[model samples]
Target chain A: MATNQQRDTNLSPDEARALRFDVEEFNTEYARILDAQDIDAWPDFFTTDGFYRITGRENYDAGLTIGLVWCDGRPMMQDRAAAVKTTMVHAPRYLRHYNSNVRVTGVDGDGTIHSESNYLVVETLMEEETRIFQAGLYIDQFVREDGGMLLKSRDCIYDSLLIPNDMVYPV
Target chain B: MPDTPFIDDGSNLPLSELRWPDDDLTRIPDWIYTSDEVFQRERERIFFGESWCFVALEAEIPDPGSFKRSYVGDVPVIVSRDQDGEVHVFENRCAHRGVEFCRDLRGKAENFTCPYHQWMYDLSGKLMAVPFRRGDRGEGGMPKDFKLEDHNPKKLNVTIRHGVVFASFSETVESLEDYLGPDNLEQFDVVFKGRKLKILGFYKNRLQGNWKLYHENLKDPYHATLLHVYLATFRLMVAGQKSAMICDESGRHSTMASAKDDDIEITEETASQMKSAFREGMELSDPEFLNYVQEFDSPWTVTMQIIWPNLIVQRELNTLGIRHIVPRGPNALDMYWTMFGYDDDTPEMDKHRLKQANLMGPSGYLGVDDNEAIKFLQDGFKHSQDGEGIVKLEPEKEGSTQTLISEASVRALYRHYREVMDI
Candidate 1:
């Protein structure tokens, strides 16, 4: 069983390394879900009270603006999925996500893991062909749940100054 | 040649020339909407030469060392906040070899370093460092005559009003207020409302239609009632409301406005389809979404302000935003929509704003319909080059109080387009 000290802010060296590995795995799985267009499964990765945001790197760096997609809880994410799947009509396309350079920054007092990673998404459409849709960094916070680690908050800060195309899906 | 009063000739004019014929009301010349040469000329003479394009809101870069990279026409630009909190707009290209300097979209950095050769620049765009300047070889170093101060990106004339920032490539363009004029300026202030802003998010999309088509769509109130039945179903707007589409002093800017008529009743058939979760009788999830909060003394629930060239201040229901259109080619345009709410919104109000966000964006019910309509319209134009499209609704008066079914705003846009493009 994990000790109270290991669960809280202070972690043994071995536990710290394990927490880093857990965050890296979470980042990879999250990207996989989005890239696969596993729309239903995407929201399950978040905690009940989670924040999911996708903002321009410019806005995040300046620390003065909000995201393009800002959701404070899982219900907002679920609502977004329902709308996109049922009501919205868009050109058919496939997305490929590439995430790398993941690093666990630290673990907070409540066993929440803070991590960051870099990402690039390439989208292919009928006439436009495959192009760089967006390239950015993700600043994330994860909490240990019953089954696995769930994302408490995730902020995707995109570096592509000019969005190559519409941001229809979550990053 | 004598100055051609920018009229329509109603004949086979060169793609470079445009003429407005007195007989034609709805149809415009095909060349104006579908010519590559015309687009190139617009980029040269209009976007890159004169117009003041919106770069970023001042609220986005409130702190020192903050920066964002954007575009003016097709030209890459960087809007930065200096140590003193002064905002500046400069060309994004490096002075050395014309490479783009700031690759990242945004960040707070005391200086920017060019990745190509390690030439560093301060936030003020002044050259700060050169990595190999005093090398061991000394012979392969930069020349002694190469001055750092001379390498700053070209500065542009900029203006800020109600926290929104505007920049002009031409130094002699009219003042921001004069450029917007009274009719459109008032609408801008009403939506922006001089408050410190908390940017909610951004929605960027690319349309295959000409940029003007989007402008025409916004100016045309005709489609809102028909193409988007959702509006009528929700009783947010009705076909019998008193509305007007007015052009600004320059005729380049316009406002399509209509007040809410509470007296108008929603039929049972329409109301059943729009039964919102938050309130049964209320069309929108939030009552504010239906409320015209009246920050200003305007008598309109909806004010769509078309700033000349690209910026649009959209004040619809409770959603307030700025739409910036970047023309990619004759057949394509990229739209960037920045959503904003005031700094003082309560948690519940913020939630309300988020829920109403559904009214816009790629997945938005209204926005998706507009996107589909714009594409179909472009397809129609592409297939039918021989026939003219009609814009002659409400012909009795040149500009009249708009009906829910009128396309007068579209006609006004073309009239203004001819003047600016010297068509």
Candidate 2:
């Protein structure tokens, strides 16, 4: 469990380290599901009211509202999942999401943990060389529900300005 | 003079080698995509020709001193607004050393100073200052004959229509209204109807195919019903629907317009053919984004306008955007997408626009398919040389058509292309 500022004041260094480890575990599991291409299970890692968006660092820094992919809630995420799985026509490819530098940045009064990590997604298209698809920071807010951590919001802000071709899968 | 008669033509092949396959618009040679010579000629005769290329939106550089980095063909340019509230388009290259000095994509800059030598340029692209004009105490400096006016960066003739900005390299280029023609200009005003625009955001991508293919993709509306299942299944745009591929008199510009029918439903067979686990249903769990609000006075719900050489005005349902095609070479292009909405739009309408935007851009549901198809086309041309693509659908018709099954617009584009390239 994460701790708020009031609770964090009394938390020992070892306890703080454990909280970070927990967040890392959650991120690792989330990455595992995404890299596995399990689109159906992808939204399960998020709460029902989760806000997910993938935007360029330029737009994020400039306070632009649009995103490459924007989902206001889990229903929208499911819709995206269904669309990508069924109707979208794209080349067959494999993606691997590498999440690192996971750190619990802060805790809200209601025990909502804020964490961020660097992510790099490498994709290998059919008969094409593997390339770095996206490199960005995952600014996330997590909340625990029913003894499990789920994303309340995930903002994938990519520093790689120009996307090569099209991004078939979400970051 | 005869000793140095052989000169660099920017490509290995001479101009004579590049010629149209025949005096027809149906057959397109593959060399147009792969040949460097054709690409070079296109840059000179078409991109930098008399066409009015889209540079920036007035909303982007709305205030005085606001500038945005853009491209007119392959040339980097700065689209800036002067203190007097006039827009200017100038080459990004520095006069001293030819460095692309405007590094930032967009910002408020009083004057542009080259980082290489600090040669200063004002908002209107006039050379206003030279750091070492008389040297540091008159030791090392530019020659006394050097004049500030003589070394200004190359500027372009700018024209704005309904807040949409266009720039041209030719001094005597015709008016934008004449360039777009009556038919195309009528459609252009549908989106830019003198209302103020609010910049939503941008989606920039490097397409791994020739720039012209992007134009052809939109102009070739036959593939719209077949290639994109999302559009077909949702009945947003199908072959049976009411649509038209309207072209300008010159055949250079076109508008592929389509109206959506709400009652249309996906057939069970089409749903079963989808290779996914969730084949039982095709309806989206959240169809809020698919709801279209009647805003524009035009009959068409979707209008994709291809304006000559480098601009694509995309109005898919309510999500409006301008796709600026910048040719990197013959093989690839950098597509800069500027998504926007009217400034008077309510918050809900704005969110609806953003929600609907998922159907376009680099990562869009329908957009990914076109990108992949284009890549496949480029690969086909690269791997198998000396082949010509056939665009013979509705061969008798040349310009605008009522049917969606025809490739008349594609043929029209090539007709104009051949005239400009003079091949």
Candidate 3:
């Protein structure tokens, strides 16, 4: 009889380890995509029906508030990417994200892998020197899919209480 | 040192002539934003004067002896429930030396003890105990004539309606109903509904802009569709919806409401095109996006209530929220947004709310854009001697119902603002 873990269709242990590496690669690629200002490629990392939200830990822990950016489906995410890229006018700056310490926290009975990682983003603006923009941990949930893994949800909990400047793009 | 040429005092500069055209408010006097004197006067006349500020909801302090501490303008206040089940609000300062009496954000406390001298006050704002009061030898302690009754913190006028709590510094301020106005009162009823509330969470962010700018942002509906395109792309709000900008008789409170499209007819050709281009009809990985269950009594998809001075109650689709503005300085304001769902919401609905919660908060796709925009406005004002941004979007109309792309409500806000400031 296939046990719950065996019955599940997640990648094998070795494959899962490799999948983690794949996720790291994906995270780096995602950051690069944002840095490149190629918003169209940003939404491609998630599943079609994935969830993406940017919320402060204060609201998240209190369970009393919503986030600034909430995208439940891929279309919504795509729509946000399109809108911010084309319509919004913001001060020009360059953001460099460093995502590390990727660890899979748990694997649910349904083969959903819960993971977390620490990240720091440094932003340099025109006529200003580089500064630490934000540092936080990314709490994410992933599901196995054909050919690769798909992100089901991503929650970024920033450690920096004060945001130096406005958050215009995805972290 | 004899007859110095008579220099003219600037008082004759014709201040009214300096005012921008009655229809336009874009070129506001630099004195409005940068004057320390004006800010101090505003603090006295508005924040500490006649205005009903929303303090806390009944749900926050439910049981007797439960208490929550918040600020009314800049004054720290304690909202507590007494043994008799009545709620009372008092300044959170010890009357003796004006030390902060309550330190906890929220808790069940029988009485608040001042750490400075150990003076105690009950939840009812009555002096309860004072340490070493009766001198052992009847010599050294609180003055023999010191009376406990005289040391109670100042109590403000308070009123509760539909589970929301409001307090005012001025005794002569209008009643809650009068303050909320008729149109906004009806909208409040729709969201609050007298039901027991469940607090979902709280989000806090500091906007580097004047507090007035935040109020104007909420009142100005023109930016909604353009700034928050997530609303349009997801069909949460469309350009063609029937929308209204409503204000109270006093013009202090405002409501921006819009109904979603119930009769959206999609032609087969368009449907096919949308499906192919964006995969519109595909099932969301999380089904919550497709869930638009109307739990509130209102027909509108979103109702953003801008209570005068510094409170906003937002009922957006499934997410219910309250935003409180705390001003740190003339240029910086802290925003505390609390999102909520009713206690009776089912697990599915709760999940739906949590999923939809992405629409608000500091990181919210819509909210972040607003924060960025507010900062941009502040930054723009810093370099320019002109302190005010033009808000003359729709000049012809008054008393709400302007075009979707106009700043009429912002004008209304400033109109009431000038009344309070008496500028």
Candidate 4:
């Protein structure tokens, strides 16, 4: 019965603007790494105890815990990265990740930044036409690390009712 | 249902025209995967025929007046709990003009009204009111013999066993208990043993392959230790483990049961047989999620059951779910997955289930491979000439077998499929 709770942010306009820019930069690098299929480097974007999950909006709205992909910690995420890179079998494909409308929602007392963004992933198989694979929202929490931001938690809530086939790469 | 005929040539390519590629169940014809005529007959002889199809779990619509849109073999239907708390299943198609009225996937509705003409129906699908029954102050009214009871949406016979709901178009179809047969019923009860279930979530995806291929996939355990490298590498379900390809009396139903024998090392001979699947040194960074608590009263750690025409009961270690296969056409199917857990599970147990969830769904470590492999099977037929696919493993046996390297259950399935489909 996990749920995304609403939070009220009371950030100064200048502070909010600066934090939003940093989040946008973080997402840019994150998407670049994924789109390039550098799956091994995917875990570097997260904290040591980072949480990651990709669940359908229907499940999210219903407050259900089951996820298409759920990683409790950075170790689990690294395990997933390894599996996708070597063990898991799938078709050879190219993916493009587009993240936009980044919104810095709140800054926690522990310096954790709550944010959300719209994401769309388009995929192309060998000799097949490209298609919209997923359209979703990334509800995230970021922690400042080494003067940059690292994702402490990311819950990708996809809006597509039916995934065309398999989501080979992480969103 | 709009019966828009795809081929005007006839009513189900005469049984004589469609033949099995071999006398025994060694080879499967390519046309069976690519022919539209066979698809039409499946609709008539299998789906709408005398078979109990899984519609929705009672947990989905737990409250009175709650309804969830589901399908019984590609035919859209609404599974509703009436105000009296009785469950009902009826076609989503409006009795008035054939418009699929139940658009929402799930909700609590006192009654349903067709948007096309505002033809209202109660939660039990009894036609409550017709928009112009008396016709605008009696000006252009009906002939007055239009009975609400007679014009209700087609209803299906529903039977529930331990909160698992099944609906059937055939009134004379055997009870769900008998239909599942004794062996399949025993495997089924291991999961649905009268415990209250909490629905975890859902995953819907379309597989670009025939629906039957999915049944074949689970029944054919020969591919499990090979295609799914993660399973083989992690010692989850490798060869030489205590496994069985079990089929019910009807052969259409089967359970691929296997116990995790992690203490036993894979022999060098088996390792060579596994080839690339047996990764030499790969390991999981967090192996705690692979924990298997002895929750069920069964010996097997995995029990993947294909319940006849539509349902797949998956109980792989701690992860539990049911996959409903909705055949769209000969080449594709829509799989609706509903993951669940016992209501009495602890918070830690819940977290463990989610962690293990990565092994199943569309992006699962194991499930993704099966989806891709089935797609490859369909693609091969689409691109090549009419040829037969071989299913000769454990060729001597035709029903159940005790070894992992046998396709006996798959052959058993085709044996029953041929009889039911009359191909």
Candidate 5:
């Protein structure tokens, strides 16, 4: 469902047409990699100085600089991936993320594209009913790297105020 | 399921029927956890009983008209600062028909008008006016003998210590100082200590377990080193560190503190003894978070003070926070975590606090396990009915512990609980 599609927020006709295809491919691949549980490769899709965070909309909307996971660079993200993949002990589960309403919101003076998409993640734990795990806006800042788009920053701003239990997997 | 009309309903039997296994406060019956009756009793005997419950920080409502919604026990209440700079806390329910007046979480407002019938109230919870109180052209309205004074919302006794605010439902609940006892009050003053509080942020979560389990989780001190390997891996709070679990005289309040031991020399024997805690391969690529600046007067790196039923004052190094436990029902409890820092925190000190946040919250290395472990305990009781738990750590049976590895505080919590609930 998240294939190559042209989506624009506030951009010229030519700029929107240029970004829609490559940016869509980058985001689709990003989601596919995480959904496929190849989580170790997550840090590779970002620049060496990339930033990523998972936070509730309450803190984000209020301009509070706090997050459930705040990693300033790729090395930190790699360490997080390592921990979640190996060391953490949590309930057995499966997760599927549905990302829609993708759009390029703005372009910075430095040619970095500010993009956003609505996401819904459904988690199915062992022998339990599948439920909507998290719903949020993935605010992304994309930069071109070696002929392909790489994320400079990604903020998962969830609307759900209260976390149900342990968020075992990174959203 | 249909046959049971009131399943899990805590039947209010005689107080004698709910007897403890013994008088030593060592064993905790499982029924107290799953009992609806015990929960209801707590709401009345403790929440509405003589206990000071932490409501909000005075800094949250710095302005005269600022107000924030909070929970006192299970009842909804509004904490607002009036025009005279006096803090006021009252039940959010309208005296008329019991409809909730304020729905907003926090806002600046001089008046709270119930949307149900358009009844208005001032910041002091005094009924200011009513829509069409007299009449519409003298036809359909209130009777001539209506008294507005009789309809005022229930006002609570508000206490402000340092920057923290507390409210008590009972008009005669002992002074906040006496209620906390001298030792606990001194520890309470340690974090609060008259320094202006700067609001940082908030993180809230709901666990599907009884509320006391969370209290016990904080009090256990035993779970810290064993369950959360991150504390051990980073050498933040190992069991080998100098720690103390101090309980008040009545065991109603307690403070569990752990110091960073700089003197411990690591030998081969010590390393092997600590092998289970420290994983060899796990390393934080960015370990700048481990850097600690001595902020407090005390040498302890981590201190968690349980203010009886509702409040948890926590200081994990420089990252300070308060946890407000709101028991939703017999089976579910919600935790409102307000993360804050002192007003005069240096820029580097602030960043240090934010980075060290990795140790707590939904995704925190140590905190992630504690939240889920509470669920695991609640799940344990599902298999058997009328079963109980044993908390006999520290064979001396003292309520306080000299080491981190003891259930002394857990027993102390129930000891006070039994006295309060009179079970």
Candidate 6:
């Protein structure tokens, strides 16, 4: 027996409109935190067991298990934030994320929502020109928590073959 | 009696503007890492000469039409399995105008047509047809007797061993076995194991340094003990362990292997007291990543093998991978890492590999540091009037040695590099 996920189509126009507004607000906050390099507060954006990964679309479509940064749970992400900040010393840079073309693709019977949006991150070092750091799609799964949208999973599927110098920040 | 077998004696100098530092393999002239003259010569002699460059794995293209984009030096090539289940690798250039025909990194394609002139070629790179061959009005096409058989993209001699693919530009290049030698072959086959491979993912990045620096890094196990803290922080590798740094007769290919001591238990107290890269009170929240499931019978839990100029086969406690190096210029090079696991891996085993993958890649605890060290070397020598690097650790011994605290393998790399480069 097939689940009704494919053919539900039961989202009313008004409900879909409201969900889109909430998703837009959620993404705005997401970009603000990342661009500000508020890495310490990253955990608050996700659930206790959220999954975050940054990989190439090639690997994502092939269902490969590896990523540039593969965080299976909240602890892994927390560890990364802690280690890179305290232990690792690398050239500092600034990043700004521009997310657009957002689309809320689906909503489960539960409060879970599926979404995708086009994203391009610009990276600027001390003296270098602001270059296109990474361009990709954000494949996301979100749910309501404390009356605000919280990410359950965020798969950053980048398009380029080569990552410049260092992907220091979470793109 | 002179203690050092080779030394910078500073005598009888026939310095024709580009001589290396004395006769010692340890003292490398800064010029080799900085000269445009040397970089140009290397492209032809080292890359196109009698060297078997790692192109792709047999498992990368699993189906008849499957393909992967790869590099042989700076030249782009398409590694595709043809309809009859035979693997063929050909230059991505179109014979018509020398333009790159295969644009996408990879995909299934029956035939490719040049976008410039629409000259069609089959999967085997044979020229099949040209659009408007006789012209729309039978007036402006090729000559009446033009032969379509004359044109094809350059094809290379490909050798597939244990699911690893090596290609050579020279048709007369020795067999893969002859090139790798018995010692290197045994080490190379240890990881390949004739088991089916499943490509897990890739991590691609560039280093702001010479491409050969990447090769030397793998050959020099001296740095692994000093540079990477995560190795010892997790008790994966500790100095003075049972290890071997083995090289082939040519000294171009080498393997640095270190066996794990399963009996040792790592704690904050034991770590801080040790003089190694171990840190006190620095333990992983998820220690499961450090577990080395003895999937192989080799004494070593970690083995980093360098197959001459292009490839690195790594088995760091069951997290297997092959990193391909593409030289962009004298100052920069791109690295493409293909991480994999056995096709028959259990879910538990797969997670183990993925968790440990944090040990490598761009943000990898150990991997990024390797990139930084090489970049520092390149920058450190950019404007130096006279500078040379000392690889004289465990001096006088240039071939395979048992000690982990040795730069003997770095000497091995330069020995073969000089012979091929005739510098």
True contacts kept of each: 0.21, 0.81, 0.38, 0.90, 0.51, 0.41
Query: What is candidate 6's TM-score against the reference?
Result: 0.89
lDDT of 1 by residue, A101-149 (tens): 7666678777778777788899987655577888888788888889699
C-alpha DockQ for predicted model 1? 0.17
Position B368, candidate 2: lDDT: 88
Ranking by lDDT: 4, 2, 6, 5, 3, 1
Q: What is the per-candidate TM-score for chain B?
A: 0.86, 0.93, 0.87, 0.96, 0.93, 0.92
Please give the DockQ score of every candidate, comma-separated: 0.17, 0.54, 0.24, 0.66, 0.51, 0.33
Instruction: Choose 2 or 3, whichever is better by TM-score.
Output: 2
Task: Put down candidate 3 lDDT per residue, B35-70, tens digits, no spaces.
Answer: 445566677788778888888888888899999888
**Alpha carbon deviation, residue B179, candidate 4 (Å):** 0.9
Tens-digit lDDT track for model 4 on B15-112?
46766765768888777877787888899889999999999999999999999999988899999999899999999999988999999999899999
Per-residue lDDT tens digits of candidate 2, residues A58-151? Answer: 8988999998999889988998898888878888899999998776777777988877788999989888778898999888888999998989
TM-score of each: 0.72, 0.94, 0.78, 0.96, 0.93, 0.89
Instruction: For model 5, give the RMSD to the true fold.
Output: 3.5
- Best by the DockQ measure: 4
Share of native interface contacts present in candidate 5: 0.51
Residue range B292-344, candidate 6, lDDT tens digits: 89888588888999888899998888789999999986778899899999999
Off by over 4 Å in 1: A1-171, B1-25, B126-152, B266-297, B381-388, B397-400
How displaced is residue B144 in candidate 6, in Å?
4.7
For each candidate in the order shown, give its overall lDDT on alpha carbons. Answer: 0.71, 0.86, 0.72, 0.89, 0.79, 0.80
In candidate 6, the residue pairs with backbone N, CA or C atoms under 3 Å apart (3 or more residues apart, or in different chains) clash, namely none
Which ranges in model 5 have alpha carbons more than 4 Å from their true place?
A: A1-10, B1-16, B262-276
lDDT of 1: 0.71
Tens-digit lDDT string for candidate 2 (B244-313): 9999988899999999987655456544543231233378778787888999999999999999889999
**Chain B TM for prediction 2:** 0.93
Off by over 4 Å in 2: A1-12, B1-13, B265-281
Instruction: Write down the TM-score for model 5.
Output: 0.93
